[model samples]
Target: MSNAKRALQTEDLTKIEVFSDPQLSPDGNFYSYVSTKANDKDDYNSQLFVQSLNGDTPVQWTFGDVKNSNLRYSPDGKKAVFQSTRSGLPQLWLLPTEGGEARQLTTFKNGASNPTWSKDGKFIFFHASLDKDDDIQNQKEASKEERQKEQEDKKKQPLIVNRLKYKSDSSGFHDNKRVQLISLNLESNTFTQLTNNDADHGFQDVSPDGKQVLFAANLNENADYELSNDLFLLDLQSKEYKKLTDGNGGYHSASFSPSGDKVVSFGDEYEYAGATLTEIYVFDLASGERTCLSKSWDMQLGDLMIGDTRMGQSETGPVWSKDESSLFFIATDYGATGLYKVSLNKELTTLYKEDNHVFGFSYDQDKEAFVLGISSATNPCDFYYLKNDGTLTKLTKSNDAFLNEVAIAEPETLSVKAEDGKEIQGWLLKPYGFTEGKKYPFVLEIHGGPHAMYGQTFFFEMQLLAAKGYVVLYTNPRGSHGYGQEFVDACRSDYGGGDYKDLMTAVDYVLENYSFIDEDRLGVTGGSYGGFMTNWIVGHTNRFKAAVTQRSISNWLSFYGVSDIGFFFNKWEHGLNLLDDPAKLWEISPLRYAENVETPLLILHGELDFRCPVEQGEQLFITLKHLRKEVEFVRFPGANHELSRSGKPAMRQERLNHICRWFEEYL
Candidate 1:
């Protein structure tokens, strides 16, 4: 076998590292991405690397023993701004475009990050939590009698914030009101506050004209409503802010149109029932009217924000052409995500379509070309540019060295009639070097979001499993996105019912049609909702010999009390408040069916994961041990729910290793 094939066949999970966060330079002359390297002690050292569009060797931009991420080019493309923890805390730093000594932009008692430059490049905007005493120390000290009187008034008027879902992924619930938007003047080397209210104003996007800032803020009247976030426009000149949209629903991650005539943002229009469906809305500043863009296109916009990170959803907000008459965006309606162009007349045209994933588009008007980040089941993401005449050019080949040695598996799309007579679409990856009429063990991999879909991208964990001689089957099931609203919402309040049957039907079809799949030696695994389903599946049936659940929710009651999103999910998924129906929550929990599980199971969790805490894994492990069922538990320290996608490189490698080890032992 060739060396590339041999490297793909190797089972040593640590031999390879994953690359992500691909950022295109403003001028489209270069591309940058984060490369994570792991050491023998499982310590992850990440750095930034930049490569030119001419496909030259990538130049390492950041040299560090610490984590450096969020590499972004300045508006004029003269500097690169990024966040680094080399000083023990993540701080914003600026590096010269031509390469020079990096200068720290902000020095606060706490960390500062997410730096964005203004359109004219006169000022740099970022978010930070300055020490509270600094804001008050400037006030002239009055007499002791006056100070005592002011202190008494301060005690009477305490900071009050009313908002739901305040807790974020990395930052826990914060009531002290620390996050705010601040701007740094490049000429004077001074810092000034742009937003200083009690509410947390996350920096979303700056207007094309640099006169206004768009952000997501919770300035609602109700503190417990799980409504959508409203978009607000902060006028930089007037120093005044006004609400852009009203009612129950909210908006997030807005971007100005090329002409600055309209604003586009992504979020759901909430109903009394719950969040109806997420879509892209374009608000015209002149007419003061909002129009849903994705409504006519029959696609749901997921994670429409400006960033290089591959999380939440792969799709970004609309990318306008130079003339501003057409927009380009990524959609997965055609079975795979591809670059699509939408004209201002509401006409849609496909620019590129393939089974692989195409996302992150940056259009260059002068060159009349666009650069996009592309990947597939066997290919990791790399920068690619498309000419006006449809010619394609690869800008960087970051993974070619590693992929040359790996025996990668290609996914074959399959269509099967579900048990309910509805057509279901999925992909199957056969084991490497497969032969006809030979039965092999199979794994039914499930995706999280229950609302999220599995695309034709390179999944490291799935590829590793296929390399280990197992046919991997993954489908969008009912609750997955890419389909219409009805299909995505099909699993609401009906978990482990229709979605479970859909997966089982997929397994049945694979076993009957694919002669290479072993029926009796099957396995199941997933995380989050998928993890919940794995727990639910093992309890209901003994068809599988082994199962693994990662960041799962075993008990709904405990999850409701501990999870950061539990309060919102409990009502949306189950339509029951914790106080309204605690018993009902327990009834739907996977732990209630623990007595029926016969499959040897493995539980994986992250220590710092508040979304699905490690306690859930602990509960399941202890229960299975007491019941004398074969089970093992693994916990990753300092990791979050996004372990597979954006967690520490070393921990992510360990996660994949543990999963393969468990399956190799029993399957």
Candidate 2:
């Protein structure tokens, strides 16, 4: 037996380092970023680190095993601020750029987060959840003893749900408190509330003159049923505000141009709501004109790229260049995330394009350079600088040791035409140590977010499957981003139709092209929407020998009442409602066809997943048992819908092990 470098092990997940939130200093001489790693507690911990752009060694700024993140630089570059949990709750902490002890800034009950420096650097703006009547000064004046008593005196009672959205998968049950925008004056050490109302304020960019702030909020009297998050600009001194958006759909990530005459952001009109693609929009402040800047540029804007790394940054921007003639943002295109530059003239350019995923990026104004976190199928994320000369330079090597130790399979991009003659984007991964003449088992891996794109990024689970001698095929079928909006919305209200055909066509394309792939010994697995697809696939066809479905939706009718977004999502995606068309929900549900399933199936779910609640899995498991179908169920305790991506280290490892063991026993 020839010994190849060891295949990536599920246990190696503990060694993966996730680098995110790269912030450039005002002088563009140094960059501060956060790196998270698995700790002895079987959980992830994060710390801050900074490195000079001039080839200086990186220095670890914060110590301890706690999570420290959201690092931001002040305008003058004299000091920085971040959020930390060293005090038991996340609070603002300030550290001098010249090196000194970090000092605590705000001590609030809900804690301060998303802190940004004011233009003059005289104050900091942040957002925090507060009771409608809670006063900031009152909490600051209370003694430590009083704080302890207040905490102990509070009673633990049953949750009373009143709002249509009472619980979230991440925050659990809600307190009915609103998230308000806040500003803290550094010189006076005083706190001022910027927003006070029933609706939650989605923070956006602060004006250049520091006299006004922009944000998105749905302040309508009937916010629960409303679908619009209008953009607003609030004057700091006058306490007056004006609405910018016309309130058609949801808007987010609004950033001011350098001239402050226009604001650039991304949002959707919600004409398709669930299936609608997010587009870039520019709102002119002087003319009160709101234009869909990306209306013609159909590829979804912002990050829809998914990978196995934990605690990655969200896709947000339209950050204006120093001249304000152009905006740089993240766009999902052709199965990868790339940094794109769009001019006010509507000419687009791919400043940095490659078969890699860029989860975060920030432009350095002083140096006129860009700092990006890019990674490929075999590489974890690390910082890279796109120089003024259009050259790329690696900035960090956080995963070099683990990368050098493991043998990961590199994916080959494949394109196949669907029945409708539309091209489907896909990738084929040969088994690790693949021999040209050897026939090996293959797995069809499906991605979630019928809207989320499967791109060139390191997915540990796919690598693990390849290491175990299974060639894997994954794709961005219809209803996936990175493609044109028409291609993405084509799968809406037709979940089991064209999208299913697209996957089958991709499998057929690989089978016809790759002779080494074992056609008779095939396996399939996916989570979330992919989980729903797996369930739908098994019930509709028996081609695969085995399958694993995770956190899936089985019955749309039951989902309508149970899942977090079921009430509206069912209508928006399937064009069906429980009250209006019960038959339609059952017609599209995978559980409706469970009797046809012949593949040995494994079901996985998170117990605390409020998005696609565990009951979805329990129902399918019971139905399969009643039918005496070959099936097994595994439930992860204290895990949410993000179990595969950001769950506990042990749980995520077990999930991978379960999938591998199931396919090994059956395939």
Candidate 3:
């Protein structure tokens, strides 16, 4: 029997376990988190696990092959509440922390989520989708027969959407149901519908006194044409709300101060629309005064590190200190996400600024420490206890067993000077089990979000490619977050201009510096914005032997009309609308240059992707075929824009294999 470390394979994705959503108890004795792993059934199993700070082993609190997340402990720490799909749809479930079996709390038709306990822990506030005249107390899950009949009825009716934001990439086509806030009384066993308006209300927090709820919503009559998501404070007794924001931009992730006299929130004025950097603000309740705390900061707020292995949500906060003197938050900067603190006196301090990703965290006021979810190039994710003096203590080695079995690739960080003398950050993964003086095929990976960043995080796809004996290169070019605001917004209105040069320059730099890379046998791939760039790259240059574009945009003209976000995203990103400047859109469309494409391109798209839409790939494939160019199209059934990241486990494996096969055949 051989006992050697094995390279990570595509199928190993199912074996990788992900940890996130860490919540330290009020007393700081125990913490709860969600651990997710892909199963053999082509689905993911996410459950809650609790561990005490006194070195107790993590206890699995929830069971079954169901998704159980959003764990919140009661104020007394005797019981905990979480959202689970064990009983069909996702609804609130309560379990005693000391002992006993779990009990379902809400039976809403649409399923309740975003559960938060009130200060006294007597009620649970959450949000659910409801129609205008629907009953809030309609807490019965429809039977299988009724659900089937409703689906049939829905198929017979035509969707009449009057608003521009009628559909989303995550939720698909919009219906009459609008997300509304609801509260469940644990003692009385009663449910109360808080806000009954046409607009969707996002539950943020409940006041310390339990008399008010802070939420985000645009109650304006013309919200259909607006992009503002203002914050509002609602009085539980009066059922009336007071607008806290000026309604000029978007605001969210708000929370009350410990004293309950002020509110801290994260927002932006939409100065550059989607490219705006988030700023923190503090609102004085009595005087109605607002102060921008992060006005001088130029980076984006929250975790902007793009990775596929991350699952479940973590609180990105301007979490108030116990004494209400300062707040702590996470910010994206220079290819890394770090924990920072800002005092009320305008003093800023870096708590933990390592060259890694702090994906999620929870602060413990009692110990004045933090439980951080950290990930590096070699680690998927592990929870750690970080002190105020910059000390770190490992809390969980969730992936230690997998790490021991698999040989992971460690990315080497590289910074290249762009053609314009700007610095572009990137990482290179050498071929697994590489030998000296050997030339390896190179694959350049581009990231989507043209606004998101490629940082020091565990990416299974890149590792799989490295295992397949290909040198993988990924970069955070212009228009990627983590850099300053100017760098991130540089790609707007110049999709294939500066951003394209940045990528090409990075490739040139890598080829010139790395003697082990075979420049002649180069390949490129990306999704979403990266997908668009992949198409653009093939059309403009034939330097690569093979290319793979997933959920890409081939024609900007069609993309402006068919995409769920096409209507407004085009104007915000391209600085042109389909109605006024059709010529400019046509000039940027990759479909127009299909005749010039010499590289063998592979197009992968999700059939249900509304973000880029399947038509984009179809157009590219048809044009390449008409031009007698080498091209192949593969579509995943029931997949969306996130097919490469969080799509079906089986489909993700197939997509990965197709990518590897294409490069193998051409490169």
Candidate 4:
């Protein structure tokens, strides 16, 4: 047989398995995780798996096309609880860790998630949504026929919106259902409502003693207008709770210390609103005093790296050590997310540092080891057993077979000086099967979040572009995380000013340094904030031969009202609301310069996107068409802002095809 490699295709999306949420059993002899993959049914399939440290074959715990995730272990390591959708809506399921059939636990009508076992393993606490007047105890799941009627009834009723933040990109328009807390007694097989309010409560952690539960919420009288996520401690017996943080800031991912007298969390004071760098804090439960642990740490905490393949959420910490002397957590620094530790006195130390993205981790406090979920440019993600002494051992090779059959491109790190002499970091991937002197078309990829960083994560789109013989360049420009607080805060109130210049500078550096790139055949593309930048780039300059913008923002004036967070996002980023200064908002909008666009543009948007509403794309398309400019618009039905990331499987493949077709035609 001839030895050859195949190019990574968009159809391979279903072939690549995504691994996340590695949970080490309390005994340190085993670990469990969730493996997700896009299935042939145009949806995703995620299942739970457990592996032993003694070199036992990994055992698949859950099965089917349904999603079984968020696995949590009991203190005794005899039982595990996880959320699953096998019975229709996602509900808590109990599993016998050793060996037995998994049994359904909760049947709440609105569904249940984020299961946390009580210290004594007698009760399991979870989060669920319910209407204000709806009884939360022993709520039954609605029948299929009832759900169909409910959908039809909802369509007939007019959506009455009275709040500034009513709609969300993920879950369209808001309903009367509010996220509340619930508890299940394993012995009695009974359910009880823990908290009841109009506002939503995010379940955080249960105290070690199990007498109190920790959560995050904004329960102010005017919660509709507030954005603060205050930490709360609720007495499970009395059903009473006390606010832990002042109402001025937002806090989350909180957990009670082993002693239960203190809480450690990640939060910010809304200094820059969404752009504010999240810091670590410890709250003294007795005096209600809060101490900022990472106040002087300039880097952003937690994983802020942007990628299309990661499927599940990871453990964001300050996970306390067995002795409670220090805590370990993930932090984004430079261009990568690494495992780091901070002592009570604020002395920081790096435990597992690498150029790869460490998305999820679980600490085996007894063994002083960790089960880490890591991903990189060539591999999707895999689990590893990491020792405190810096020893690393690969556990499961989720994508090794797939990697051996395909040709993948690795990115080379690059840095350049912006117009104002500020440094910007980025990466360049040369076209696969590249020849030394052959010139290839270049594509500049931008990331959203203006606050999120693009690091050494496996990006399917970037690799696909390289396979098609296009040199790809992606950068973490100003406003991106991982950089210092000053650098991240610099993009706020500036938008297209400095951030745009940083992106342009990155392109210039690549063109100047790389001989294999053809500058005249350059293309540009991005989604969300990156999409806004793509629109701005084409409008401000005619250098790019083609451009594709996905789920973008064109008009700040319209976005202020139509978007779910429009009203506040504008003021936070641009420093002015629509009412504050209409002209200022209009002046910064990309639509204002649509007539100046000369590059052929492809506008891809999800019809159901409420964050950067589909109207944002419609307005731009119409404006460019009216001006007789080169433009085309493609709308994905029933999709949302995450169309490029976790949208439907078929839609995702089609989206990639459109992007490549646009560049191939223009270049």
The global C-alpha lDDT for each of the candidates, from Candidate 1 onward, is 0.75, 0.88, 0.91, 0.90
Off by over 4 Å in 3: 1-3
User: Measured by TM-score, how close is model 4 to the native structure?
Assistant: 0.98
- Report the C-alpha lDDT of model 4 over 493-535, residue by residue, as the tens digit: 8999999999988898888888889989999999999999999
Ranking 1 against 3 by TM-score, winner: 3
How well does candidate 3 match the true structure in TM-score terms?
0.98
RMSD, each candidate, Å?
A: 6.0, 2.2, 1.6, 1.5
Which of candidates 1 and 2 is the stronger one according to TM-score?
2
Instruction: Give lDDT tens digits, candidate 2, residues 1-667.
Output: 1235788898899998888888888888888888898999987788999999875778999988788999888999999989997776678999998999999998888778889888899989998888989898655434557767865665455567788877778887677689999998999998999999898998898999998999889988888887789999999999898988877788888988877889988888887776677888898999988776677877788888877784745334788888888888888888888888888878898888898998888788757788888889989888898986798999888888888888878889999999999999899888878887999998999999888889899899998998898999999899998888788888899999999999999999999999998899999999989999999999998999999999998999999989888988888888877988999889989999999999999999999999999999999999999999999999999999999999999999999999999999998
- Give the per-residue lDDT digits (tens) of candidate 3, residues 63-129: 8888999989999999999999998788899998889999998887878899999999999999998
| Consecutive 10-residue window with the lowest summed lDDT within model 3 | 1-10
**Candidate 2 similarity to native, TM-score:** 0.97
Clashing pairs in 4: none
Model 1 scores a C-alpha lDDT of 0.75
Give candidate 1 misplaced runs (Cα > 4 Å): 1-4, 7-28, 39-41, 131-168, 173-177, 221-227, 271-276, 303-315
The regions of model 4 sitting more than 4 angstroms off are 1-3
Candidate 2: give the clashing pairs: none
What ranges in model 2 sit over 4 Å off? 1-4, 140-156, 314-316
Q: What is the lDDT of candidate 2?
A: 0.88
Lowest summed lDDT across 10 adjacent residues in model 1 is found at 304-313
